[model samples]
Target: MIKRITAGLLAGTLVLALAACTATVPISPTDSSGLGSETIHVGIAYDSAGRGDLSFNDAAGAGLDRAKKELLVQATEATTEAENDQARAETLRGLAQGGSNPVIAVGFLYATAVGTVGKEFPDTLFAIIDDDSVSADNVVSLLFSEEQGSYLVGVAAARATRTNRVGFVGGVDVALIHKFEAGYTAGVRSVNPGITVDVRYLSKPPDFSGFGAPDKGTAAARQLISNGADVIYAAAGGSGSGVFEAVAAAPAKVWAIGVDSDQYASAPEAVKPHILTSMLKRVDNGVFQEIQAFAKGDREGGSKRYDLKVDGVGYATSNTALNRYKDDMEKARYRILSGAVKVPSK
Candidate 1:
């Protein structure tokens, strides 16, 4: 249905808009004439909290950095603003028009924007991460079993909590965040149905600032902590920093479970001691694999799933507590991968 819009007309409208100022980070050098050459020019449009978030965007940035160094590819990166549909659309169009092939949009928010822009540049390949809504032939959807990974961390939270009460903090109250909450709650219940689970979302849609606001995360985490939650799992983006900060400042021994990347390695050293484990979503692997596929003259379209069975989703084992619970987590991982245990993604 997105194809109903005239591609030529949309392209014309975006030509002048490309010069508008926006928050962007250039990852690599530019090569204008490398359209069909061996050189792969990647353009990434990141979600809120851009690079250095040490969470989701940073994971994607790691992949691009690897491709630039090892694959010798050129890349340009742009970031989107909070709840700005026009900015998201213009950013994607700007990347395509700038001669970057296989431009990647790095969040579910880019679904509608990518669908609209990919049509204008039929020759340019486009990919979207965490979104499967766009079904264009030129669009490659990079999906992850985030629920599966969240489930693992939930188990860790339930097992490590001294007080049988754990909490969950989400960046936004959307269907995607719901998947994290559902899987986490299910995993916690699977461990001990009697365990109390408290859940809270930072903000609703259209107020995406929740993903970037550490102070808001701190407030939410404190409330959960006061309510007797000894362990907290945060699926918030950069806002997870607030959760970690709160845990670090708590007088009691509070533990935190991070999402997306390994918070133990990515988080600040002061907060590292408070992080019990992390839910590994493997956004870096997905980005690298898609770019590698494009470079091999392969146009892999449709919804590509990254799940636990393929090492796409898993848990970080950097914390010392993992030594005690390694066997249990491994067994849980096997059961889920084998389909013996079904994790809800609601």
Candidate 2:
């Protein structure tokens, strides 16, 4: 049975801690034969943004930290430099070769790498986040209903907007981000059929630098703000920081919605007030549960989905600004949970 991992506040500053570093740093290995060892060494290969993205990567790191503290597991982490399949494969392969069992690839971009490396190390179990296309006996896919959470945040944005216009900024124009856009747009429209929703993507596929480019995120937000959008939701990973900056600098009051984590807690002091809410994807829970399962000797592999039914995806309400709309959002949440409202994932 799939278990629910409780979401908690991350302990640390929210700044992009490793925004520039991009090299593989291997940790000392433990017993390679995970079967008979008292301690298990875990390995994680993050996407280009790495540990300090303050969004996706940070969530994953939180889980790793919890495992170390509670499960007593040793772990080594690496970030992809070139963001290509070759670099990702090498990172996974290196970790497996170093005796790190149950190596994890943090983003869907590592799908090809996971498939390639999982075959090479059949004895070592593997997990990949955000993607489940890989078919392997030793690999488990950790998937999430990102669209469901995005829909909740979209409702929040629609309710908070003063101009009756909202905006969406995506890091890349990929199918994954598309799910975010689809649900968010639907949520906004559900509140008001005539609301104007501005959508922009920082970069398209093949040039995924948008995920790490704050400058681009700022530019996108500015454009939306100029178009009279008072509430903006950013699913642009690290670029979401730029969206918050733009909203904070806007002449009139505006709100920015964050993705993946409780960005209000991590945001700078000045920007915190402007953040309405964030779509909580609960990647930390996924990471922590996977490690916990492996530690308990559950090696079965396949696709495991985290959806609204499992409390895997939802909206954060840290800011008091969201308190006023709590009932509305909660009603929407009930509809989603009851399957009365089927959130689109396209």
Q: All candidates' lDDT scores?
A: 0.81, 0.85
* Model 2 lDDT per residue over 162-214, tens place: 89999999999999999999999888888888889899999988999989999
Give a tens-digit lDDT track for model 1, residues 215-280: 999999999999999999999999999999999999899999998889998777899999999888
Model 2 clash pairs?
none
What C-alpha lDDT does candidate 1 achieve relative to the native structure?
Answer: 0.81
Candidate 2: give its CA RMSD in angstroms. Answer: 8.4
* lDDT score for residue 111 of model 2: 94
Q: Residue 155 error for model 1, in Å?
A: 1.3
Report each candidate's C-alpha RMSD, comma-separated, in the order given: 6.9, 8.4
Error of 1 at 239 (Å): 0.4
Error of 1 at 22 (Å): 26
Off by over 4 Å in 1: 1-37
Deviating ranges (above 4 Å) for candidate 2:
1-37
lDDT of 1 at 316: 90
